[model samples]
Target chain A: MSPVSFFKCLADDTRLHCVLLLQHKGELCVCDLVDAIGESQPKVSRHLAQLRECGILLTRREGQWMYYRLNPQLPAWAAAVIGQAAEGNSVYLKPALVRLGKSESQASCCD
Target chain B: MSPVSFFKCLADDTRLHCVLLLQHKGELCVCDLVDAIGESQPKVSRHLAQLRECGILLTRREGQWMYYRLNPQLPAWAAAVIGQAAEGNSVYLKPALVRLGKSESQASCCD
Candidate 1:
């Protein structure tokens, strides 16, 4: 993706948080993101749709659940940009990570 | 800056070009960007103002010209994002760089 398109995908709070959380967690479902980000499911799902449209994310289906992960085919630079943001901003991701951990321990949304 | 804020600064075409140009060139004046990107001076300046307001760019006064550059104190991650965008997308910047080179060879904006 062009830099503008790539950056646009990350310009919003929901999208950025979702992308970063996925980067950290490898993959997550919509319910997991809703639990972690504390946003309504529809809102989180809307942003995920946008990211998927932009090709920054890929979705997988297993039975009834859909999982999202950073697209493996993302250009190297795009992946690097995500990596830098994810690695460099732990404090920003901590609260969501905690929520995600709590939700996962309580029986993951996918489970 | 927060990743969302940082990415927002680069989400627009004008702002993204101005920023990536500034990143590639080290520093530039409004006129230089106008000449390079072929956008109206006011439009370019307005975006530069936003970048400055977002703390992604710093400006210095030089006689009748105001020069813009990436803020040196920008967090490492921010700088890395810019660097990755610049280094990985030479083709996106090529047309503007050509114009910038021609503009410089003829007479720089600050000169």
Candidate 2:
């Protein structure tokens, strides 16, 4: 991806949050992100669409659920940047992680 | 700065170029950037203003020249991200860097 596209993909906090969550979680479904971030499903989905379009994220379908993760094809530097952001912004990320933990502990529709 | 602000500041190619240039050079006057990036002086200045307003960059003036550099106050992750981008995107950055080298070799208005 072009460098500009890389930055543009992450320019929004919602998108940045989603990318960070995926970095920390490995993978997550739309429902998981919605729960973790406490935003409307539509809003989160829109951001996810932009991310996917920018090639920053990839998605897979399992049954009726879609799971999103960072695009494995990402350059090492881009991946490292996301990794650093996740590690360095733990305080900002804690709430989302907490919510994700709670959501995952319960069997969701993805199951 | 908010994570969103961090990304927002760099979402555009022009702004990203300016930020990466600062990351590579440490400090540069607006004219230096104009010379490096081959963009108009006013255009480069506009992007620099946006970067400065976003807190991603800091500026200082000496005599008739105003120099810009990455804001030292940036979080470790933010700085690392810029560093990684510069390293990984060297091919895309070479033209600008080449120009910077040539410009610095000559005594510019900044001198």
Candidate 3:
């Protein structure tokens, strides 16, 4: 992604939440994200489109569900923004992180 | 901000760049961001507005210029996403971060 585009992607809290949902889990469909984040399906889909356009995320389709994950080849500039973001303060960021981890474990064990 | 909002903010790449621009410098106006990110004036303004709404950023107006910074009290959920974002791969995130640091140093020494 271009420099400005990265900022655009990260500007939305919902998008950031969706990314967090995808982080450990690898991929998720719009419905899955809706359940994970508890939002309307359209909202989740819109944010997913934003994430894909920004290039921070990638997608796949199986049957009818589209899944997304963190793009592995992080550019240095985008990487820097993310580097510091993790360290900054936020009340919701931590708890959501905990839940995301929990979900991963549950899915892994079930699989 | 709530979990969904944070992800929404982060969904846009341009917004991510602006936040990174603000991360080190403490604050920035729409114009400064326009210059820093090399986008149009109104575009920067709109993005700034988005950041402000998401609560990942805080803003101030001095004379005609409105400035913004990373909210110091980032929710844990947001912080976790950022933490992983930095570690995850993005091409733009790193170089933009470098430019941001360079600009800060230049300004500090000048001051």
Candidate 4:
């Protein structure tokens, strides 16, 4: 049930879609999440909260908006999950993440 | 934070330890998890349940026992997480899982 929850948390296309957006992208504002995931504010906010509560993401309040980023506490294996999912997806996600100082040109796999 | 939740689900040493045992081992009973992770039966059961709830593991009922195996529904990325963590540890995990029709030689990385 525990591990299933982990996968279930990730199983959602919207949530995974949101995660791939924020991952390695540094801090992203709620506006960006809404834009990228194309979901309503309430929907995105709820998903973000779920991820935050589980410790997969961290947030920073800047001015009137909160910025989200991948938390450093995640195990190294978590990176592998991101890499595997975003392997071919970097073409779209990398460009979007360029503003965040991350370049996902290719998924870096262990050699 | 959605991604963070995924990491937190896997954040526990006990759960990760149990996951490694089931990843490619076909199916395992709770007893195997207890033996491999050296945790109490309740602890192992909870962890296994968590994994199942997350859609990472699947369960089946035998004559008197329930067998757990990695869920095929997991995204390919999940396998990478397991591979990354078990890269160097397969020496131990694989031998223990041979009874489950699995072999641990070396981690296979994408080239």
How does chain B score by TM in each prediction?
0.96, 0.93, 0.72, 0.73
lDDT of 1 at A79: 91
* Candidate achieving the largest TM-score: 1
Instruction: Give the per-residue Cα lDDT of candidate 1 at B81.
Output: 88
DockQ of each: 0.83, 0.81, 0.22, 0.12
Cα displacement (Å) at residue A8, model 1: 0.6
Tell me, per candidate, how large a share of the native contacts it keeps: 0.73, 0.83, 0.32, 0.15
lDDT string, candidate 2, B1-111, tens digits: 777778777778788889898888899899989888888888989989998988889999998899999999988888888898889999988899998998888987587
Arranged by DockQ, best first = 1, 2, 3, 4
Worst ten-residue run, lDDT, model 3 chain B?
A: B83-92
Model 4 residue runs over 4 Å out of place are A91-111, B1-78, B85-111
Best by lDDT: 1
* CA lDDT, candidate 2, residue B96: 91
Docking tier of model 2: it is high
- Binned by DockQ into CAPRI classes (incorrect, acceptable, medium, high), candidate 3 is incorrect
Worst ten in a row by lDDT for model 2 chain B: B1-10
Question: Which is the better candidate, 2 or 4, if ranked by DockQ?
Answer: 2
lDDT of 2 by residue, A5-104 (tens): 8888887778988999999888999999998999999999999999999888999999889999999998899888888878788988899999889888
